[model samples]
Target: MTFKPLLQHFKEMKHYFIVVVLVFGVSFYLGWANSEQFSHFLKDQLEGLKSLSQSLSNKDNPQMWFFFIIFLNNAVKSVAIIFLGLPLGILPLFMLVANGMILGYVLSLQTHESTLSIVLKGILPHGIIEIPVILLACAYGLKLGMLVWKSAAQIFVPVANRTASAELKKVLTLTKPLIVIIVVLLLLAAIIESTLTYWLVHL
Candidate 1:
């Protein structure tokens, strides 16, 4: 069997990826510009994160703990969005917007710090890979959502002829393998974030 590069196939759905980026960007801007409006929401979220961090901060192996936490968190959420997106893609969109907004809100709170410095010193090291992986997951999730919508339409109205099955067949060819790829990439990102990013941020 002749194998085609996944990149080439991914291009077939560039529109989904583009939409993901745009939605994330807009949500991020809103989070940054109107952070005051979301202060309570952000605080509640951060408290939960802080609790999780405290629970997981095993002194015996800090780096390993970081890796385990980051990887597991990203991997589970990333994979969940894809399948969870089946409901008209709402969950994926919500996740992306929420995640982006959370990031922006956090950065906005760091007003006394140089944002560029913080991003370069902290985020850029791993975000280069991590952020893209997440966006890609959200993109796939959005596509799955659309497919479900089409499927329903076809079921209720035969003339609607959405061909969701045929569309999904193409996607399925990549979905399983693609998830493995996402996991591997997120693993790499986790490693970088745990070690390299930690060093960079501390240094």
Candidate 2:
């Protein structure tokens, strides 16, 4: 299969990448500002998850529901802009950064030496596909936001009115497939991560 679309997908996601980084920068600042509080929060969450996972090991447990919830929560945070319309850019970016930081901090809390192993084993399978898929979905939102901003600008500039129709059509066409493709890829990635990757890691 061609990696070109995947590469182009990354290229298109570049804008969101910058936005995500900036959001993380802000999170890092917050983290830096209140290190103790943040640290405590991370520790508590980690311990809570571990306990929850352990409890769910039994056949009768309902904690398995958490897996789906967590999965959807992760997916929604990345694609939240879709429903929010043009206003999604800032919030999605913020969510992305906060997610990365939270992930980084959580891994750190788990084990320093095994950090790399844990991340690779736990995240790589689904993350490789899922993260990009999420980014692409958000890109569609960004494209919409750009269109709206451009449309609003047309009120002041005659040139803005010149090609709005054509440009808007192109944007809509480009983004529609992006939403579908991303969702498909994400599901495939999640499957690989949950099954094959899980087995390999244990091996």
Candidate 3:
């Protein structure tokens, strides 16, 4: 894929980006706004990761906890996605923002050097695809929530007159494909992250 195309795609998903930014921004502001705190957190996480990586270097299988780790990670992601995708109007978005904040906070805790290593070892292996896939699902959830919001606005319409058949059809038409794509991507990531990544790291 052309770099330009990816950029354009991201450009079109400005809302998703914005939500992530707002969430991460608030997180950084609260947890690492101070230079000292940021630096300390960064150093700590880096050192911790470095130690862990070094320890794994001699392991016959570094991914001894592979299934457990991936399961935990997926569980967190799924729960967050579901909670944030709920059709409770903007509540899901708020949850999304909060999720972003927590991620940012954790990331900020890593030192740049360690962060780079972590990116390569912990993230890049599968995160290249996983992150985007999750974000797309989030966007779909956001879009779904928006539809529900619109439907809610018409709640006062007499029940007989307010047949939401058209709206339901519209949502399903747009959402079905999105759901399929997201699920496929998520599954692909899980496979890569769980199996391939485990072997690669251990090797």
Best by lDDT: 1
- Cα RMSDs, all models: 2.0, 5.0, 7.3
Error of 3 at 159 (Å): 15
Candidate 1 RMSD to the correct structure = 2.0
Model 2 bad stretches (over 4 Å): 1-80, 83-85, 160-166, 197-203
lDDT of each residue in 1-203, candidate 2, tens digit only: 44455456667557766665565556655654555667876567568767855665553533334445445555555455654446524555545555555666756555668768877888787777776565555555665666666776776777824465566565555555555565567657756765666566667
Please report, in order, the local distance difference test score of every candidate based on alpha carbons: 0.85, 0.59, 0.57
Q: What TM-score does each of the candidates earn?
A: 0.91, 0.65, 0.58
lDDT of 3 by residue, 1-203 (tens): 22343334445558865675465457546544443545565556557646865675556664554444454555466435633664643654554554454445555668977767656776687877876665555664565566566567678655655435455455445554454555666667767776777666556
Better of 1 and 3 by lDDT: 1
lDDT for predicted candidate 2 compared with the true structure: 0.59
Clashing pairs in 3: 42-111
lDDT (Cα, 0-100) at 17 in candidate 1: 83
Best-first order by lDDT = 1, 2, 3
* Candidate 2 residue-wise lDDT at 49: 68
